[model samples]
Target: MATAKKLPSGSYRVRVYDKVTGKYRSFTAPTKREAEHKAAEFLRYRVDTRDTRLTVREVCQRYINERSNVLSPASIDRYQRILDKQLSEDFKDTYLEKLSESIITDEVNRLCGKYTPKTVKTTVHFFLPIIRKHRRDLELDDIRLPKVFPKVKEYPEPAVIMQLFRGDRMELEVLLALCYGLRKEEIRGLRSSDLSGNVLTIRRVMIDVGRTSVVRENAAKTVNSIRSITVAPFVADLIQARSGDYVTSMSGQAIYKHFSRVMAKAGYSITFHDLRHINASVMLYLGVPDKYAMERGGWATDNTLKKVYQSTFSDQRKRFDDMVDNYFSKIYDTNI
Candidate 1:
């Protein structure tokens, strides 16, 4: 039930009692009759909200559907996995509005014990948006997350990457990753038509999703990802020799399996993606400008160049330091 109150502006304000929250919800109407009508609608809405038991699972399903076209296929798969695997079973059936910070925090803490800190962080990251959109009353500030440490990405030496490039099975894949710093999906996404003279356009990426091993073709990772990169003459020659519409016929999983065997046989412990990191390290070591390196590697931002993939080989750093030391010695000798 709601009551009407006369306002200073001569408008009738309707106040409705929200039984669930025990708070008064107010709405303004121009006339007393309109105010009463508005209050009745508010009470009806309160009843409907309580009757509708939309679960977290339902909200997550809706979220995925809404974001399917916007997010990359891989990202959508990740979100689905988080909802199904990472989130606790206790809350899946709970109503969206009924969830509290304590319940979410307990679940997150339990997940931290089972999963890595990064995985737990990802779970929380995906969970917040759903509650924000559906349960605006649930305050997220009470949830305390565990401390997360970033894992440092280690890159193989330039010589190690070169050695992989000479291998027979994964030669082309290694070359594309090492030379252009292309991601695994980007390497798999390359097509013959993408090659125009010496330049290669990266407009799309191939993503492997789900347990079924379905490969989905999607647009580039970001807006800046759709750009052209000039290939070295050797890379161009290799592309010219390759058959099929795409660069390599092997799927990303197949390439990874091949790369693992190649590394095992060669007694080097490096992942396929290490080749891309090696390319960035070499570029930074050779004093390539940040902008040029970002553009050449299809990196969307300069921060990624500086923070993510800028580790130089220790030997190269030593050589650079020695050069500086020698130059300073020469200057001192001239002054003396």
Candidate 2:
């Protein structure tokens, strides 16, 4: 339901109302013709009052339910994490009207205080569009995305990461991650049957429940994550030696709790994710192609691969020397 009213002052006021909103938000325009135009837009954004109090959690969950099937499992997992572990908590009980920019910025800042800018940015990114979508549904306008946060350049050296790998409860998990670059959930969810012929088929992942943060065995992060990796001989031996009935099964909390202890106890100033970065960097250094590394890594973008993971290798370092020797050898050898 919408209408345009002519204010005595000359500007036209366009107003729209829906059962969802219970009342109309009027848009004032400078002319009658403009009022008609604005009225149409107002009608497009008019929300029903039955739904006036849209909560972030509700909208995000609905969005996940209706749209997530189209996304790869890995991507779905990442989105779920940003929402459940971060967004859901901040906006758990908030209404869309109550969710102002100040609150969002402050909450994100607190999250950034604990995580890297890259991580905080991801967290913000996952929710911004969804929030904007809801705002549009409510007829809000000019919604914008926030700036990407910057990450610290400093990190622990590989030697330090290796030191964090101890031979104990979490040692095997960290070893699998470092050697194979499997995600933490991937490392924790391996079943004995999934391993054979020196290959491990990653078929499942565990994630925190949207509301509770409790890990549950569901589908793997993405269909692609349900992949096979040839285990290094050492890793194969380590898998064989384990006494557990399943090769890779454990509660998600186990990895989190232990990794935290190991990092704190070892003073290894790095995140668990650094293991993946170290692995990808090492593989590129060993002459693996970008495609191979990206496929093996379940990575989503080349920039992330090239900028974040790729480390220049010997080939690049020695290209000039090798080319000079091979292509100009005759010139160097000439008597003149």
Candidate 3:
């Protein structure tokens, strides 16, 4: 432990040896005890792995291995997939010490040609953290990545969405997504125990990794995602009619395929995930407050809620505007 010394400027500074940098690092605070405490805390949790011989791929694998117990299965699977398919062999083989900003930028630019801008951005974002875990001193600022444009998604009216799946095998799935804004994973993870009368609690999630589905109990996409919402009478009846440990027996893939096929036949090309947009649109259409809508949809922030709200159907906006205009016109005529 290094003792803190008062400087000419009247600030306390402590010099602590960092194993990674092979040099003494400085921690400064207003008080002598605070400076020493800061240095001591750093020494307590400092990782001593200063292995300069590790390659980029090796560091990524090491990170993945270290976080295996903590990270979700789906996250691990996606990381592995990115390591295998997204990373270039040359980039992976490059030594961590030798990796430069230009190398990362070049790889990102190359990936933009092969994959979407969003995919390229995701790959670079995931790769950067692996590098930084081992080499904290590296400045990876302003590594140019492809710009991700906001995608315009079209969703059908709530009524049409209801009519399409009414009395069908996937009706329960549709109702859960549209009525409650429950994610597909949450829907698959639902069990009879999760339903108590008309109130359905979203507590678990089932994510697909490779060919199989992995269920995580008492877990969801976010803390806000684990919520309880009152279900509609028809939705409650549908859940009661089903006899199984899980509410819906369909796998994630099966649900997606069935939803897609049904939607395709109706001449609308939309995904099961888009039901959430429909849910958001309905909330916006019905003038549901941002707070309640966000809670129901498991949105962590109002930013996402505002995006969906702003993207509400053009026709619906026009209809509402016209109705208001007609009402104003009638009032003006009465005054004359």
Best by TM-score: 3
Residues 119-201 of candidate 2 have per-residue lDDT tens digits of 77677777777776556553224333345655564555544554546456565677677666788877766767778966677
Ordered by lDDT, highest first, the candidates read: 3, 1, 2
Superposed model 1: Cα runs more than 4 Å off:
1-52, 211-218, 264-268, 301-336
TM-score of each: 0.72, 0.58, 0.75
Give lDDT tens digits, candidate 3, residues 1-336.
979999999999999988777898999999999999999988765654555478888888887898998999989998999998889999999987777778877887789889998888888889887776666555678777777888786777666767777678998898788766789999999998888986788999998999988999988987768777767556778899999899988989899999999999998899998887877776776676566567667885646645544554356544543443343234333433
| Candidate 3 Cα errors over 4 Å, as ranges | 1-16, 21-50, 136-139, 301-336
Clashes of each: 0, 12, 0
Best by lDDT: 3
TM for candidate 3 is 0.75
lDDT of 3 at 281: 74
Alpha carbon deviation, residue 244, candidate 1 (Å): 1.3
